[model samples]
Target: MTAVIAEEDINRIRWHCRRGMLELDMVLARFLEEHADRLTAPQWQEFERLVSLEDHALWQRITATSVTDSTVERLLRGCIIC
Candidate 1:
């Protein structure tokens, strides 16, 4: 909660990341909580790009089951253990 993200910004991102799927919500929210504070501007841009994806596509990239792009996959590699 103490990340550089202002309250409004966090809320906006939270809203965007809030998916109907519980698993998606948890993983994305947790990533924001744990890593948001340390993210550089470029990382934030990448994250915004990732979150903008549809739930299924984002899940695919995060899980590596059907990676469409190596760049996004690489960005999330460290955050996702699977």
Candidate 2:
């Protein structure tokens, strides 16, 4: 059965996507595409809302991060101070 997605959920997803988290963006994309057919009316609405955000705002959010770390650094250092 299709699941209903609320507008708030879409906003949250959009926020995450704008944050420039590759992992999160990919996850959300996969989820929406996979369940496209099964989405309820509300779910579809939420998805549409996500698509309506300004490109600049989305880009800024997606790229903004508290700390900058390279992929290799994360893999090897593992975010450990010690």
Off by over 4 Å in 1: 1-4, 65-82
Candidate 1, backbone clash total: 0
Error of 2 at 59 (Å): 6.1
Q: What is the per-residue lDDT of model 1 for residues 45-69, given as tens digits with 9 covering 90 to 100?
A: 7788888999898887787755455
Residue 41 lDDT (model 2): 70
**lDDT of all predictions, in order shown?**
0.72, 0.47
Decoy 2 TM-score against native: 0.33
TM-scores of all candidate predictions against the true structure: 0.73, 0.33
Kindly report which residue stretches of model 2 are placed more than 4 angstroms away from their true locations once superposed: 1-29, 56-82
Clashing pairs in 2: 18-61, 18-62, 19-61, 19-62, 20-62
For model 1, state the Cα shift of residue 74 in Å.
Answer: 5.7
Clashing pairs in 1: none
Worst 10 residues of 2 by lDDT: 72-81
Residues 1-82, candidate 2: write the lDDT tens digits. 5666676875565554443545445544655445545666755565455445555544343345535343321221232223
